[model samples]
Target: MSGAAAAAPVRRLAVIGCGLMGGSFARALRARGLLQQAVGVARSAEARARAVALGVVDEATDDPAAAARGADVVLLAVPVAATEATLRALAPALADDALLMDVGSTKADVVAAARAALDAARLARFVPAHPIAGKEKAGVEHACAELYRGAQVIVTPLPETAADAQRRAQALWEAVGARVRTMTPQAHDAALAAVSHLPHLLAFAAVHALAQQPDGARFLELAGPGFRDFTRIAASDPDVWRDILHANAAEVRAQAAAFRAALDAFEAALAEPARLRLLIDEASRVRRAWAPAGAPPSP
Candidate 1:
């Protein structure tokens, strides 16, 4: 209410967590005139204050239930580990017909948690989602309204999820400039484990391994652009990554094994000078012929 302007319509949106992803969603809603009023919920008083001060939400509270009490759309944006607890806290407050969605990186775990926490009627309105775009940075200060632009957003709905709820969730993401896609919770987890989770793990491992060297600090200081780009995700929130890794352990492990195999093959090629030259030439040709100028080749 404090941040509401004279003519601004209020859509009564509630965002749990108010971190980078949550704050960005709220900001996007307001920027596009999609929400009449937005409220933010976070555990810390400082975060609540920051959200309100930044105008990401008209009101902010530390109580999840209080924020979700009458929200038309509730977005759970907490870390994967905390998502279940947050959903549990808000379950009683969520309206039976209100749309409930999440931006958690993993889908299956969140879907299971929502099933366990919400009542049958409330569960029907839940739509589990993951926005496939983010920065290595964390916190509300890093959130931007345009963060979701041109990004893929996967919406995973169980059989119990209402068709209307799923449609609304997809519409909301599309409204925010995202390309909404549908998948089962299992498929979503498996795909993300390969493209997203595994890459993060590799990046983290690479950085950690490099840091263990005697000249690690000096090496990092002298690192080039390729190293910087490859390792950028290593700076992502540790707690969040830890939860994602554990949530999709099986798929992540499989992807990791595949990556290890590829690395071994590369190493073998390096041991043979002729093969090494062939490898470089083949890689260069394929990369030049197929790769997009600024984007990775789509799978």
Candidate 2:
């Protein structure tokens, strides 16, 4: 892992997707004076218009291929399922020396997609990345320049990834006020499955289970802060999360099973007061100890 200081500005950045992650990236770089111009691509003309109006990019287009042409850097922030298709479309338009990266939640699938979509020459310039930051809120409307500040951005480069490509990806994220770390795609997928994917599944399940009851609306009316905070991620865009979860299904299932086993143990402990107390004490201690003095818990 390495930290990046501000460096020379990128001549042009083509941001595909132009939604939360992509919009934030462009805005952050612009704020830091590290970007000269940015072209944004979105599925809808309305979204493209909004991105430009919000200053997320200097220009906006519905055609990703046209946007990618002559770009110094190409960022694919589209849904995980659409990554391969996006890469394929951008291949012909890609500058010979363009740096390619992504903000997809799952790394393995994105890496695989890039490998399948690009020729060896283009693959060498591509570096897979995931910025571990987001809000429950969705869309380009919520994007802000400070979103990546103090955030952790994981760069998972393949064995064949060029050394210069890896360095450029790291430096770009760092210039936008992020801490960069490197990991293998497989390791990145497994870790994210446990910490991110499984928790989202749990949140969605909690909300869905409640909504299926006869008194669902009544329960929701009586819900408090704990319920709200715990299930906030359930409000995330279903379409986006569906693509991510399915792309990394195997690891997600394994992590979900592990989580279920822990829940079962906790339920069984409820029958024994002493055992339940011990479980509570252990969880409390661990959670409390996770934070250093005068610091808040990590996201």
Best by lDDT: 2
RMSD of 2: 2.3
Off by over 4 Å in 1: 1-10, 278-299
TM-score for every candidate vs. truth?
Answer: 0.91, 0.95
Q: Worst lDDT window (10 residues) for model 1?
A: 1-10
- Which residue pairs overlap in candidate 1's backbone? 9-36, 10-36, 10-37, 11-36, 11-37
Per-residue lDDT tens digits of candidate 2, residues 1-299? 13334466889999999999999999888887789999999989899899999889999998889999999999999989998999999899998789999999998889989989999989999999998888888889999887887778889988889999988888888887778889988899999898889999999999999999999999899999889889989999887899989988999999999988988989999999999999899999997776432222454
Find the 10 residues in a row with the least total lDDT in model 2. 290-299
